[model samples]
Target: MTYPEIKRFHSNMLESITSHASQSPVYQDLETISDIARLSQLPLTTSTQIQNSFDRLGVEKVLLAPIARFWYTSGSTGKPKNVYYGKRDLDDIATGFFQLLYLCGARPWNNAWVVTAAGGETLFGLVVEKYGLDGTISPLAGEMDMIKALRHASRLHKIDIIVTTTWLYLLINKIAKEPKEFERLVETEVKKKVKIPVFSTIVTKYLLRGINYTRLGGSLQNAKIGFSHAEALSPYLAKIREAYPNLEMHDVFGAAEQWVQAIQVSPEKDWLSFFLRYSIPEIAPPEEVIKGKEDRNYRVKGVPWYEWKKGLKGELILTRPNECLPLVRYPTGDLIEVMDPAFSFEVNLERGKMKITLPAIKALGRAADSVDFAGADESGNFLGFKVYSRQVSDALMTIRNVRWWELYHVKGSPGKFVFLIIPENNVSDETAFKDELLRSLVNMFQEFTAAAQARAFLVGGTAAMEDQKNYLELMITRPTAYELIDTEIKQRIKEGRSVGQLKPKRIFVVDSDEALSTLTRKKMEA
Candidate 1:
């Protein structure tokens, strides 16, 4: 049951290999994934290739699809990449999304509003609101427009569910909290609006921020259910629970590159149980990916999804039969941890109650994001320290009044680190802010640095260790500078960019002067 799509995947793989192997664009030479074993033999694929050369990636089937839709990622990595979906693929995704919505208490009678721009990831949610809900869907594009939409829907007493990104929700709440006439207007408008539920696919940091501002008026508190996905939920579920107490927070996991993978079986549980009806899943442990003297072949054989046991941590590999995109053992880049299977959970489907006990899964960021710092150990053995970007992001969230921020790792002989931040208006003490920010980063990254020191100690490279220590410079920007930076970002996006393609991380490695100059610009005429 875990790999119901295997036969289909094998057939597709065969067709692609026999018909288009030599001339196909993304992959030049390829082995056919005829069976589970052969699937393991296929080389891994990365997002970089998908972004830079998607047209070459088995596009024959895509061209032949009866109906095809194209969406591009927000070129945050440099250039926006296009993702193709066939009519059938989109229909499956839309159907799964709607089912998740229905499972989360949404109904056709409920007046739904989607507060996202009309592109990329938002398109899926828009589809769900349109197809799943019997109620009318109000698609609001921008933050101000979202507020207005909510107000209009509330005035009509028809707002049952409002869907938006967590950041936009926070922005709306922040504006409502301001002590201005506008705040009074928002408070009055919100108070008069219908108490509706909210759904968002967001990062945890913004969820906390949004929850803190939910009390601006009774409108947000009326939000009984909050469905979120696209990021880990367990880490921040407690905070969300404490904020609302009555709000039911559900997690739904999916990606633009792939269809919806999992959804919470129940609001009471923090598990995102995978649905086997989608793509066939496989798990590869972290250790197997590393090469040894005897084992030059590093990619470990991944276990089937059904074989997954609790506490198993590995990179998720998927095999899809969708003809528009034939993905065989494609490394999704997402690291996941397996959880216990649901004994039996019933979801009130559109027709009736459906029972399931699929194994739950937890995403642990991407393998690319967890960078490895290689050095020799005391015995002259090579040791690599994996520093997860999530650690840095988690530390950033700890800093009070930080509205948004980015950590840039500038490459050099001794690479320098720069932390740019936009603090909330209330954070006036810049000196204290810098001191606290530096302290937090140092503490969070202390273990990684210590590992480096131990590596130097083993190799007896004192000078090298000193250089490493010098490379760990952390710099924080002035709080108010983010306004100028924000303006510049908006201008760039306006020129033609989808927000979905933008990098979700505040931390990134900078390799060029052009990027540095743009990032370091401080003068503002506005």
Candidate 2:
């Protein structure tokens, strides 16, 4: 914890930012935050602001240069916004990632089974793969839909560790539980002339199910760890633990703009420790986020990392000024709660001051956006409970083996929302799966439904109109949601409706018949 780099980070960041051509509105009156108290008074910046002010926010020299990587956010509507980073920025990113890997007990001898696209232009996947060259990497399919990628990975050497998204890990977990079924799956998918069921089962059993498989002179099950990134792991942690009790799981937190911001210090805890050396971190209460929704002009004031109290909930704000695209007071839209100090470690801040480690934080869901759904009243009200896409998507994806899914609200429709789900391939009990899915959905929206019913009663009307019969419309679909989205994206690009990199989103709200028709065209055509 006594790393000298930590002390120099703050001063270095301020100097680098101030030296830039500060033409942006965000930096019009800005100078320095050397005084930590002054940092609290600055207005918080949201992603929407960055998207809207991209032209005005750029430092001319950096924007015109070719030495930068442009990444985009996967927003629900419209064209995605781009985030730029320079070569030095990528180096810093690698350093941060290396620190996290080291903390997770990763060594040069480790072999990683990575579930990510091998040739795609995904920003996070590219960065992780680049920095992770300290060890061997065997790229697996990020989704079951990528049959060729999966087949290629199945033929790789034995794995010492596995790194993937929560959804893909669940798919692997399901396959590992049934080696015979997995054998049949590989035989069918690879399209080989000969059947290798026994061989397939042996490979799967040793690579996925057996604890005695050797790695680095230790049991592979004990040596092999799993890391889930860019999403919450809490929703799927218990199920993963039940399937592979010996596997150590780690959760990582980051975004497109600021890659690898924080990582879980230990496998035993849910909280994350921030990489303070890479970025300046801050937080504001839930009330600030709610207030900003009512007024777009209002900017919330945030407390610096040093000022956050244990148990306090707020969104993460970061200042990474050394990048090609500098972000100051950037609101990441992710909600997190500060946790009590997990351990004690002393460090020097280079200003003749000694400080202990910062408090850990647990990620809550993202800040809620005001979304009008099918169950809303005629006046576009949904009782008193505020509904957000993150809330519904997070709740629905908690169901077992759910890979890609979405909830859509059709305009002109009352008391109904379409829940389109794509379960993993091996889910056999359709009835039970649907029932469990409905149960989870109902549990998620129970409060909103109860409030709606109470409002109806007070108005001398029964709650029959808003009952489950009227509201719940579930569909288990053939094509994965990602496939449909990718098709749309490709079509859009071909028609010149989009340019540069585009990010596909999982959940969306369509306001017109034409837009809705486009999404359902695949089913209609079939």
Q: Give each prediction's root-mean-square deviation over alpha carbons.
A: 9.1, 8.1
- Pick the TM-score winner: 1
Query: Model-by-model lDDT, in order?
Result: 0.56, 0.58
Q: Write the per-residue lDDT of candidate 1 for residues 410-437, one digit (tens) a residue.
A: 6554345666666655456667877788
Q: Can you write out model 2's per-residue Cα lDDT over 1-526, one digit (the tens) per residue?
A: 4434453556566556544525455455656555444555555556666565655655453352345565544443445566677777666666667656756766546666665433222443454566544233433323233343344345445555667666556656555455466656555533442357676556544333332212311322343678777567777787777655677888887776776777775665666777677778778765675565445556667877666678776677787764455676677777777885333433323355443454688776556433433344542335534455445655775666675666666544333456777665546777888888888887888876676567656765665434534455676755344456556644444432212112244445666547766886674343
Task: Give the clash total for candidate 2.
Answer: 0
Q: What total of clashing residue pairs does each candidate reach? A: 8, 0
Worst 10 residues of 2 by lDDT: 211-220
Backbone clashes (count) for model 1? 8
- Cα displacement (angstroms), candidate 2, residue 150, comes to 5.7
lDDT of 2 at 328: 66
Clashing pairs in 2: none
